[model samples]
Target chain A: MRVVLVAGTTATAKIPEISAAGADPTLVGHTPSADAEIIEYGDTVRSPVTPVSPTGCPTPAAITRAVRELTGFDVLTVDAGLAKPTAAPTIDVGARPGRDIREPEPVPTAPGAFEAARRMGLALPEDELVIGETVPGGTTTALAVFRALGETFPVSSSLPSNPTSLKEDVVAEALESAGLSPGDAAHKPKLATRYVGDPVLPVVAGLTVGALESGSDVTLGGGTQLLAASALARHAGAAGDLTLATTSYLADDVPELESAAAELDVDLVVTDPGFETTPLDRYAAGEAKEGAGMGGALMLADRMGVVDDVEAATLDVLSRLDPQAVDGVEDGP
Target chain B: MRVVLVAGTTATAKIPEISAAGADPTLVGHTPSADAEIIEYGDTVRSPVTPVSPTGCPTPAAITRAVRELTGFDVLTVDAGLAKPTAAPTIDVGARPGRDIREPEPVPTAPGAFEAARRMGLALPEDELVIGETVPGGTTTALAVFRALGETFPVSSSLPSNPTSLKEDVVAEALESAGLSPGDAAHKPKLATRYVGDPVLPVVAGLTVGALESGSDVTLGGGTQLLAASALARHAGAAGDLTLATTSYLADDVPELESAAAELDVDLVVTDPGFETTPLDRYAAGEAKEGAGMGGALMLADRMGVVDDVEAATLDVLSRLDPQAVDGVEDGP
Candidate 1:
């Protein structure tokens, strides 16, 4: 089976760590590597997705375009966007349907990605189709997505470095701004995500639904990815191969991720040398903790036995800026 | 509010990282410096605890000693240890006492640690105890502990580093050995821990009870520690100040930790990293992902904003290898 690692900013950061984890470098790419091919989706812009308010969700069209450009796989975009001004329900109902609106729109990203897969004679039938994401402030979006889907858990921003109250304050502010109060409602998966959430969650949820419908073994990459995947699984009422790939940093950043996984009924896999590995030299020296998503993904890829020679792969990718070079490299497992 | 950092072997490995995180070297010794104070708890000569079975329950004495040494506070041991092995129950009961019973006993190592705090006139009229633990294979133990506590969720090892099948096999084997079938019973906290469990959990449960009885503010250090704390809060029928200190890694390691915190009926404070910091490294490299008790405590101290320098506090404790030096250091906030 030809493995397609959907590279994002987060995954790209982990190129070196992924290589160290034993993955074939030929199959990975951040910008453009001399090894594995790079998939550059037109819509996949590296914008400052952080500091996003609950007012807007990501442009679905852009996401669709990006998926098409990167994977060349048939992408389905579910219309799972939340209402701009979310309403806080006063009454509590156990697992009520549509209690939290903002149902996802059933739209697929460009059919190009999927069509390209077909054109390349790639057989995805019954094969594992791993889906990962890179949504800054994704956890907040996850909280909103779950809330809209009827989950009641309090979702908040986590301090990426130390998992301290400073991070919790950001999460709490986001949640409050979104009209969700911690510990007020009985936390369910869908409800939590919808009330205080982000855009990528619905995207992942839609993708998970599509993957399951196709009967493909799916691995959801990152903690936010898994949260969306788990919510989708619960909503669809089906169970198949769905695994969560994340770094140890999430364990501390949002201790609630594990419980969310349990509620969503999914499996979890911890990526190695997560936040801990990024030499604290900067943060300990009063430098702000930097390089979280990328560092974590790289570390995760390495720990999962996915790649070898993390630094080399990272350096290789960093050294090259050509997309074609990324596509033509033959580093294999 | 004096800041006292507890040092462990893992911290020694991350000295440069710790130093980089703003710790002052001059303050890290038995003697208190201008900014902070230090407490050196050398790694005990306790035998290395391993996961005997997939159940991953640690020896009670080992966990107790570690906790006792780490936190020089009162020890509260739960009386749920089984005298002999019992077969897993086949039926599920929701929230019934004695339905899950495989809890372990708490063992105290430093008899004077708790008393010394009182002698030093540090006892608060309000309980000011903070609980921490050092149990190997704690996440696995958490799964068992949850099961033993009657949590019906399908608990698996938080080992993404290994093959998916291998983790499943271990979880399945452990369940089988315990004579319990997956999903056979409604998952509860106590039952889960008992059947597929570890010792740190019950000890944590006891600590929660201790905190409640003492009416003190409690912080559960580490992901597993938080998990146990949440479970204890749920089962013990107490509501007080209970905080969780963990790393971002745990959020990725297992989402269940997040889920459990949400289930908590008490005040929940999860100290994660602030979003300002980008590219947060997961856990520092070369250390076990599970042994984060001391690190979490340090972060918690930092988050309180009471300590001027975490690095200095840690070093001050490290420098005070001699017990006499520890006594001579002037305590500072």
Candidate 2:
């Protein structure tokens, strides 16, 4: 399947990993990927502009512009933006003894991009569209988004190889300060984003919704990217044919993602070798529960046959972006 | 005050982060840190003996031995070992699913290390004894240790920048699989460690017990090191002047560390600026917490200070072993 990698931040880093993986991929960024097709977005901004703090958000307009610049496929962006009235208020009550709060606003950017694609009458060459994002602090935002969506998962407690506990604390505090208590699923996703989230959510949610509405197959890339896909499925009221692609580590944790798939009552395909456990086994073992659309999208990709290595596949996708490097391609306008 | 940095892992990929930090810090691995002291812990044994998988345990003995060799400090290893025990076969069984299970048992090595230190009549130094560790997949182990210690915090749900979710999932599954659900204060830490833990637990527990018995001030460095310190405080049933010197991130996310401090009633001090919010705020807000014993230990030397911009105070400490490097005064062995 041809993959169009949508980057939110640090687009360059993902390129080499994708291009080296031997996939037909294109780079949608202001700068050209060294080895892949380069589709320059007019809204290429610096990383610090939207500082990737635990609560910092990415610019949706940039994502929309990037997608518009890259492809002619019909896009559907989900409108998940809600005014973050809680931002100033939460920071006001510094360390006050209280529970955290979150809002449920759909992400704003992805929907806009999708809508623009639809307006342009873009048609997918195939039945499936692989969707992804590049938001800094996305994991923290994913935790908040899951919580905001009424999923009872501990979103911010793991200390992976990186020891950025302070960032996690900042996110947790921001959530708590906003009154989104740990187990309270009453808040909407938009409010949570405003209170303690980034911009990847709405965009991914929009893509999922648009793809489902169009009856097209979609592949969600990365763990946070899958979370966005799950949120979109939940909103669309149907899972459709969505594929969740990411590293093995994510498929192991966050049972809520699986639970969300189950709730959606759809097929699930996980494109990572690490997620070999059966869906039922995951749930029975308390490893994970099929989420809203678990069955439809939760399938594991056998690396041995499909690709030599997932990392290599990602790198290969990155390498395909440079028109100058393509052996048989004509020069672009 | 003097700091002793221990460089255990000799991976070429990992060294530059330390060397560029510009501390002129001492290098303790086979190769030396640039322009500092060099104590070689040759590649006698490969670290992270296991492949980097989604769910795996760290080799704590490797780290402990490296630290012991680098510092010449008395070693206190955990006294537990793991061998796959057959499950009692009695119930109706179907196809046994393909599952990855790791058992970590604490094995305390060299009781003489503790006894020897005591026999030496070693008095507590002006600066507390700071201990750090380098163990791959330590975060997974840290979560297990935290859960084992009866901390109800989500053992693994948050994302820590790294793409691996297996560590997070393993911790979550261990808590649920062991049936040690959260919200029970009566839970025993040892029981949890036996099921889903690594060797670091008991050794850390031993260190806390040893330090309290000796009545000395101590500082636990690194993320996993702090987790070990927390385990020590929780299981040892002793509390005195113990300070946790960890990255700002742990001080923020792992609620158990703070809870352990409160439970042990010890002070918490994070050293990294990027991971620390309050410490960073304190530095920024001009309310720096300065204790007589808390100032930089390695800052006194010309080679000390921000080595390569990342904290090399630990490296500075490692450099001190070569007495000639400091003031040209050679101290005989």
Cα lDDT tens digits for candidate 1, B67-186: 323333222111122121111100011111112112221212112222222222122222454555433233444454445455533332223242334334444555666667654433
* Predicted candidate 1 versus true structure: per-residue lDDT over A1-333, tens digit per residue: 112232121121122221111123322222211111122222112211211112111111221222232323322111122111101001001111112112231112212222222222122333555554433234434444444455655432322123334334444554565565554333343344344433334334444555666666666655554555466556646566666655454444557777777777777766543222332111112111111122223333454454344334432432232332222222211
What is the C-alpha lDDT profile of model 2 across A14-77, one tens digit per residue?
2222111112213222221110112121211111121111111112222222223233222221
Scored against the true structure, residue A234 in model 2 reaches a CA lDDT of 62
lDDT of 2 by residue, B121-206 (tens): 13222224554433223345556556556553333111223323555566566566655554231334444444454433433444
Error of 1 at A31 (Å): 72
What's the lDDT for residue A227 in model 1?
Answer: 59
Please report the candidate that would top lDDT against the real structure: 1
